[model samples]
Target: MQRPDDVRWPVRVARAVLHAQATGTLIAQYGLVERAWPAALPAVPATRLGVQANCLTDVGVRGMDEAAVFLAEHLKLQGLPEAGEPVERLSAGGWAARHAAGEHSDADFCAVIDAQACFAGAWATARELVSAVLESGGPPRSPGALLYAAVVAGGEANPPVPAAELFALAGKAAAREADALLVDLRLAAYTLKRLSHPPGALGRLAGLVRGTGDAERRHALSPADAATVRALAMNLEALALLKKAAAAVRTLEDNLAENRAGHPESVGETLSIAAYFHYREQDLTRALELIAEAYRLVRRDGAPDRLRGCRKIAVAALHCGGRTAEAEQVQLRMARDPLGFDEEIR
Candidate 1:
């Protein structure tokens, strides 16, 4: 909803928060927070809903127990909880007692987990979210779960749900057709996406999906390439977080053209990711083509790290395109030792 010229503080924060989550990019707890408002501390969030949204995001990422406490008090001061009926009351003992007694399916459960996750890791919160999704009478609500998953990514994701359930439920949703597919569980995918060191739990989940090789791909890029990777990933994350997948495709298409003109090498990386969006759009042919181009560039001119990453991306693109054998080959190449190279792709 941002205009080219009218982009401001609130939009930028909103964009950054959503982008961070969508790409599974882990924003560090103490990551340098750049202010978009330029010395003005008085900046309203883009929308009224953003008031709570931004506050909740900060609480989870920074582990601001004081802020969480303040938020609870402020809600009470406003005659909330009962007044805010659906918004669960911030009663630590009461909530915790319920949680211990396995009564976490309450509608307000995700909110409670979101608040407590400010102190605790996102793993337990994720587990609770999964529980909520499993228990939903109707469909999964992707946004709320998406928000929590991204916020939780600022910390480690220990994935509280049994890996098997995560694999079964999540994999089924990923494979289903547009109509029959569970849209809400896409948030579940994002939560799992945030898992970096998915040794046992994630490894097992990867195993559930026949030969997708989705989880086998590790990040082979180096610290030197971090900025560019972050930029592209954040860009995609923003679109996904906004739930504007189709529009995101158009936006990224324009961005890819601009980047291609300015930084030719960057096209491959951006295109590789654009392929992911295309895959989401159910355009496997386009996705494979874009990824193939990226793979060519990375193999020819990419640095050692980028080559490895591009290979991994190629594998992902192929898997999404249902070209599993080709994806495996790419994975094998990615696993090979570098041929001695180092340079920024963008």
Candidate 2:
């Protein structure tokens, strides 16, 4: 089948590879290669090599004849002198070695490393790469690299630099890259993590969330305003402001109702957040109602990880509502199908 020309296809493939790496499942990794490899064959050299390198690193060439064939084809396309060598004998590390020998662009290398760091929990390497990139930079070289740096710096363990400074740096990159919404969301998340019970911190997070919502409305983007609102509500809950948190959740629900068509995943996530808030408030009935809706949406249209999360919430609500047997059944289903592919719960 002929694949459509999509300039962003390489990035999507890279993300799938990263997700496979995070899941650490051979099924996920093989599924990505089978689906993405053919489509990516027609991409540009840099993109193709980047995607190939990421796949090879995450899923070794062992037992995968298709991977070997594609590697040879990609090398030939790139005019690499060693194209005829038996790829079956080459380890995944060999691909990295080739890239390090100047076959791939620095951007691709950094991007792959950033993916590993971001998704695969290679934080030490990510911190090092980000520091090197920033120290040698003129302007923000990569928005994603900077964002990863900010996330690493904001983590609980001792940061390489102050989280605030890294976040500010990331903000600059976001402005240049036109990714302000993502930066705002990260900043809001950081605030929630760092602040214990300060009203001022919560107020700042609310402002960030509000600003993100305004920007989304102006651009007619997918109404991720619900997510920001939900984050703000979570911070309110952290501060023991239950009523205010409930109000924020209501706003989240309203946003979902208003823009349900743009992104079903976001709607599902917003509903799940609301259910958790209701669960915390001891409104088990309401919590179950919201979570059931979320489960149905995610089961039909969301990723396995999302379905798993929604199921967890359902279990919590059921267990708290004195339905221990039903909760156990759900728990058993969850354990049996970690991917959340089972039929709908009764």
Q: Please list all clashing residue pairs in model 1, or write none if there are none.
A: 19-238
Clashes of each: 1, 0
Q: How accurate is candidate 2 locally (lDDT)?
A: 0.49
What 10-residue stretch in candidate 1 is worst by lDDT? 31-40
Checking candidate 2 for backbone clashes, the offending pairs are: none
Show where candidate 1 strays beyond 4 Å: 1-243, 300-305, 320-322, 337-346
RMSD of each: 18.8, 11.2
- Per-candidate TM vs. native? 0.29, 0.58
Model 2, residue 145: distance off in Å is 2.6
Per-residue lDDT of model 1, residues 1-346, tens digit only:
1112111222233234334434565242221122212111223234432112232333113322332332232223232111111222223334344544556433344443433332222233333344444444422333443344334433334543343333334334443222111222222233334443223323332332322222223333333233333334334343444356787688677768767756464576578667767877878778767766765565443133445655565566677768788788766655443421222211
